[model samples]
Target: MKQHPLLLLVTLTCIPAWSLQADAVNGGIALIPLPDSSIAPEVWYHGQRVLVTGHDGHWQAAVGIPLSQSAGDDYLNITGSSNKIPFTISHRDYPEQHIFLNNTHQVNPSPDELSRIHGELKQELDDFAVFDGTVDPHALNLTKLPVKSNQVLSAFGLKRFFNGEPRAPHSGLDLKAAEGEPVTAPASGRVLMTRQLFFNGNTIMLDEGQGLISMYCHLSQISVHEGQLIQAGDLLGYVGHTGRATGPHLHWSVSLNGVRVDPRLLLTPALNASLLPH
Candidate 1:
């Protein structure tokens, strides 16, 4: 489950260049080779802006394919370019996971809770959509692991049946941590949100420009405030089972262009290989 080498990021993490020959799989990233341009061309997919940067001798777009993407033809639209960048996505069948929650309210929220849930979901989506065209794309490096742990990521994209009922697929990587353990920022970014979400509990969302965002959820405490700027390794919160969680674990999510992809794809090669594919 190693990922294709990233032009800007792979050198920092020693992952072999060929292990990820084809990254265009479901719930993965599609590194679409782009045309040579003095300035990176703006790319878009389904209305969301994409991260286009220098790759080798040319430019490319590292698209975050949504888990719901079909295994078929997909294209990226280069702004003002008539020709589209066509890439084929391969299908990937992620395994299922079942969890029994004693909290009935978590398994099924009340009508009032549902209303608040919808609002929180919308706020998060809006935060994810901010592209931050002002920031330098290359300066935004995603090379650090938020939590230091010997255990690799084993649960991501799990189609969970919570309390015998189907729920949304797990959208983030879970790192087993104890209560009060420190959680830090993976990259330099401005904190977009620090709120208690319905299912996320105490959450902190960071925007790293070019629509590359990170969210740390299910915390016992939030150490940062909204609009605060933080660098790599800066503390954002502490681990806790604050939201709809079973235990004290950091639910770390990395969303590119507003779509949730496998977080390990952006990790160092050694760390990436240790983490199993979703």
Candidate 2:
């Protein structure tokens, strides 16, 4: 089936005259212009820190609208600023996907397994809450692809059903990586957390400056340790079918300000123009 790009309409009203840059689509980013390069204002959206970047004496904050966000008015708050930025969010429909699982245990875990899963989920949430404000804000640019393949086995934001039972939406991009294939960091960042889980398996979460973070999951091996600093294209791990996966592949996810956006959005032309230098 052909994949369609999800669309969202955002309207900004009663805000400062700072130019509204970047697309305002669902799973997309919106760049809110800042007062000056020196003013690193604290911006918040959906109770999470907004990723900020500065260039050429101008500063802008990037806010990622989640795919599940309904069409309506949304607001961003800048601490100590009197004016509130109001923007509209539009609707985007994702396609449904069905997968049959041979492992019935994964589909319906035992009581002990459920307890373990809950603990792992809490750890992941804590990791995602981290935001390192020390790194260069301009380092938010994702310079490389995590895996070597251009083929995508599955797109992001698809509603998935396992063995005729509906499950959570697909939250990340699935790349076509062979078993034991090397996975690398797409951007420079510090390792935040690494752990194996029932759903994600061996996972490495990297904090790429500000509120930009990336995760590589279902790995056969992890080469980096927690708190380790990694450069772009640095080896993170090897791909595998370690978790609930049916086959060997890489599940890569990108989070902005704690909101899970499409990983491919970072590769889009619109983001490259605004986030990357010419």
Q: In order, what lDDT does every prediction score?
A: 0.80, 0.78
- Candidate 1 stretches greater than 4 Å from native: 1-22, 137-143, 152-154, 275-278
* lDDT winner: 1
Listed in order, each prediction's TM-score against the native is 0.89, 0.85
Clashes of 2: 1
Candidate 2 structure quality by residue, lDDT tens digits, 74-112? 888888887788887777788898999999989889999
Model 2 clashing residue pairs (backbone): 11-88
Candidate 1 per-residue C-alpha lDDT over 1-278 given as tens digits, one digit per residue, 9 for 90 to 100: 77655643544323223222228887788888888765668999888999766545567788888888889998999988999889999988888988899989889999999999999999888988889877644323345567776354446678889988999998988986789999988778889889998899999988887888889999999999999988888999898989898888889888888898877777656656665332
lDDT of 1 at 200: 96
State in Å the error of residue 18, model 2. Answer: 18
**How many residue pairs clash in each candidate at the backbone level?**
0, 1
